[model samples]
Target: MPPPSPSPSGRLQWADVPPPLRARLETTLGAPVTEAVTPSGGFGHQLAAALRLAGGRRVFVKAAPDDEPLTAANLHEAAALDALPPYAPAPDLLGVHRTAGWTAVVIAHLDGPDPDLSPASGDVEQTWALLDSLTAAPAPASYVAAVSAAPSAAGLLHGWKELRDDPPDDLAPAARSHLPRLAELEAAWPALATGDRVVHGDLRADNMVRDHDRGVTFVDWAHATTGPACVDAASLAPQLVLTGHAPADVARLLLDHPATAGSPDTTTAFLAALTGHWHRNARRPAPPGAPGLRDYQHRAAAAGLALLNHRLS
Candidate 1:
């Protein structure tokens, strides 16, 4: 059975943007706004919207105030986006605006719905294509340092160690049965994490926009980092399971892909770490502003654990 799909736990809306920030966005576009449509997923932006400027140019903008944590992420995203190679499979960076204590990053908008990841959706092909382009491209020198230097000062690799130390009260029967093994497998991936390709640390249905005319474009590069080639495609496993593919099928699909085909143990340990992180964080208190986050993590944990268990078995 597929796990529940997750959505934004909290997002800042267009209407809620401060007037000064709104005005700055329009001025950056060189026209007044015609219409604004905010996408329904993603917790990173105070404003993640597609805007139609009066003169007919359409662009997507992500903005947030200093108080919102994502506002700080926006700066990193801006730097990363600006440094991404020309052929990188991402939207074009148009402008960066700062006003009224808000930072807004604008990029070309795509005319497509979020990709569908049901068992047989065509977007599955897009997922393959995205990783092919992303993983094959050498890490840009500008982004390598920034991408390689992530601030994981906190123990943030999905907290598997924490989970092993103190299993959650609500752990699933499958997980509770193999807690020790899961912890062991989770420890096996850090050595494999180093690599020359850029990795999008977070990959899910909501992080993509599938425009048939344009193919697929990945957004939210704040989480992008340098890692082994297969890590990018492998990172997508849990999300694929949550959308409708069986855990075994998802594994087979990744195993078949050229970009991810060879790293069986890396994939297993990665899933274990991913699963452990989600399971551990799901039971913690939800952060302020995103009430649905715990449930989302909980469901993702279920899918990741299911995949992890399948691989371990």
Candidate 2:
């Protein structure tokens, strides 16, 4: 099946924007918006559009209501993009706007297609190169201190234990049978993700944009954080499978990465934790204002579990 699709619930059109916010955007670009287009790759669950100005400038804008949870995420994204290293390939932040109804971030437009993670695709290598660049420097001090201070993956990877305590009838036979062991294995995850490198906490094909000239530029820094360098590389393993690579191919990719080598147990634990986290979250009701998120979580859980089973075998 194709990847989960983007939702329209929280999306905003140019006409939906308040006049004051539109005026602010015009002022930032120093011209009037001539065209606005909605891109179709991310699960932003809020306002996201690409705008072209009369003066020929282009920009990407993302916004959310001030009272919504995504508002804080928008702010974090702005800070993260502003603080990224010179070598990191990401869009430049142009400005931010906060009015009574909306909080928005304006960034330079990146014209490109999403990377192809299909088996043996050159785009796979491009993604790897982007990850290499991202981890080359430590995360920004302020960004790390603000975002990493929250609970680590260890605290959030215990879905198996929770499910075991009150079993879900729909749990897959493999997962149901392995629940106890999965819980035990996942307990080691926190230590595995501890390191001084910055992680794109949510790395996936949709979050990557590949330009012929710029190579690969990673977008959506809302989930960026400071963690073990290996975590970012490891996180992409299951996605490789989801996008057409076999489990062995994914394993080989990991083995070849220096940062991921000599950490078989850690990799396994991290994958298991990821499976648990997605499995648990997939069964819950979609959060308010995010209509398609739960379905995406379910698909991601299946992919993660498939990779986890492969590693276990």
TM-score of each: 0.89, 0.89
> Which pairs of residues collide in candidate 2?
none
Runs off by more than 4 Å, candidate 2: 1-10, 140-154, 288-291
Worst 10 residues of 1 by lDDT: 1-10
- Number of clashing residue pairs, candidate 2: 0
lDDT of 1 by residue, 153-193 (tens): 11356567777687767778898888888888778778666
Model 2 lowest lDDT segment of ten: 1-10
TM-score of 1: 0.89
| Each candidate structure's count of clashing pairs | 1, 0
